[model samples]
Target: MIKKECCYYQSSTVKDDPEDEESIIKGMTPNPLLKKNEWGWAIDPIGFRIALKEIYARYKMPIFVTENGIGVREELNENKTVEDDYRIDYLRAHIEQMKLAMEEGVDVIGYLTWGCTDILSSQGEMKKRYGFMFVNRDESDLRDLKRYKKKSFEWFKNVISTNGKQL
Candidate 1:
């Protein structure tokens, strides 16, 4: 049960509100404490646990977290490495939620991140990246396409090696 954005940016091309309701509902509101991303919205990592509890209560099945990450605008340093502490922070928060859900008896089988390497997004934006590894290519410019490991790579490796205990 992977969770990302609850609300997304509405395209200017679209004429009407997709939900046909105001962005802000009376009782239903987004969390204010979560960190905001480049897209001008916050992601509730705690919601992951809440959602997991609800889903586990309704459907008793082994859950898998697929496609979980943040799309941040970043760049490689002159040393050809990316110090993506933001990605690490995002992942750590969500993983902490998963741990809490597991403590509450949710059967989470596996967790998978969105992308291991930089890839073209559906909107054709390379700047909006969600990857532990950075590919040396842009939207219009395909450079060497060399894969460079980001700071999150080592952190993720440690997390996996510790069976998420370190996280």
Candidate 2:
């Protein structure tokens, strides 16, 4: 539910909450004080891109999409493979939009997505996962932290191998 409710690349309709985020940055609010993990509202990349264009036009510096992705659960099958199509879809959409943004004259440097492997959870639920590499070990079972490439692994490999040209 948290993942579904979170919108990392929402359009202009999203109400800007930079002021609310200021309190978090200023330590007036407890860590993760905001609703769910939406605490990083000030770090909205879509909003940042719009701001960057103004800076780029004035100073001509390279812009960057520093973060973006969908978080989800990953449990390995007996065969040791992970299916992470959501992450792939998330990146693919953002990349397409980025291409359009660059074509429209934004000097973007690169996109750096978060989390390459499964991580421990905040809510202690074993299902809340986000990674291309799946770790067999969950919050409950410290089983040998086995790893598996997710479905996006091949797709991302092809895109990166082609310098994002194939994408």
TM-score of each: 0.81, 0.63
Please, what is the whole-model Cα lDDT of each candidate in the order they appear?
0.76, 0.61
At residue 115, candidate 1 shows an lDDT of 85
lDDT of 1 by residue, 65-164 (tens): 7778888887789988999988898889889988999999999889888888887777988978889899888878888888999999999999999999
Candidate 2 — which residues are off by over 4 angstroms? Answer: 1-60, 121-126
Clashes of each: 0, 1
Q: Top lDDT: which candidate number? A: 1
| Residue-level lDDT tens digits of model 2 in 127-161 | 67766778778667889877789887788888878
Give the clashing pairs for model 2: 72-129
